[model samples]
Target: MDPRPPDETPGPGQQPKPPFDRERFIFKTLAVVIGTQLLIYSLAAGVCGQRALVGRPVGQICPGTLEQLQGGFDSTLKLLLALLGGAALTRMAPPS
Candidate 1:
C-alpha cells in the first residue's frame, strides 16, 4: 500500500508551483534588465553631444557619454534582440 492517502490536497501556503515558473522568472528578469539599459541609452543620447544642458556648454559632450551611447546603440540593442530570439527559441524547444 502507498503511504498516506492518495487524494490528499496540499495545505495553505503549500500550493504547487507552476511548471514554467523558472522560465517565467527568467523572462521577467531579462525584460527588466534590458528595459533599464534602453532607458539609460536614451538618457545618454539625450544629454550628450551638441546639446546645451543647464550647466553644460553647447557642443561639449560629457565624458563617457559617447561610450554609453555607443554601447547602448550597439551592444545593448544586440543583447535585446538576442533576448527576443532566445525567448522564441525557448518556447519552441522541447521540454527536457
Candidate 2:
C-alpha cells in the first residue's frame, strides 16, 4: 500500500515559523505614520496663519511691523510643540 512515509514531519529547532503577515502590517503602519505627519503639518500651518492675521494694516493704515511678525513666529513655535504631542499619540497604535 503506502511506501513513502508519514505526512507529519518535524525538523530540529524549526518549530513551524509562526505565520507572519507582513503585507498587512506594512500597509497599516505606513498609513498611520503618513497620516499623522500630514495632520501635524496642517495643524501647524493653520495655527500660524490665524495668529499672523490677528492685527495690523487695517484700512490700508500700514503694513505689519516686527512685533506683529514676532508674535506670529512665537505662535508657530507653540504649534510645533502641539504637533509633537499629536505624533506621540500614535505610539499606542497596533504593532507597537
Give the alpha carbon lDDT tens digit for every residue of 1-96 in model 1.
788768756789898655677657867886787777778767766776436556566454565676666665677568757877988999899999
User: Considering only N, C-alpha and C atoms within 3 Å, which residue pairs clash in candidate 2?
Assistant: none
Q: Relative to the unseen true structure, what is the C-alpha lDDT of residue 88 in candidate 1, on a scale of 0 to 100?
A: 90
Q: Per-residue lDDT of 5-80 in model 2, one digit per residue for the tens?
A: 8776568877765677765575566557556655655665555566659853243212334345446556655765
Q: Give the TM-score of candidate 2.
A: 0.37
Clashing pairs in 1: none
Provide the lowest-lDDT 10-residue window in model 1. 49-58
> Please, what is the whole-model Cα lDDT of each candidate in the order they appear?
0.70, 0.58
Report each candidate's C-alpha RMSD, comma-separated, in the order given: 5.2, 13.2
Lowest-sum lDDT 10-residue window in model 2: 56-65
Global local distance difference test of model 1: 0.70
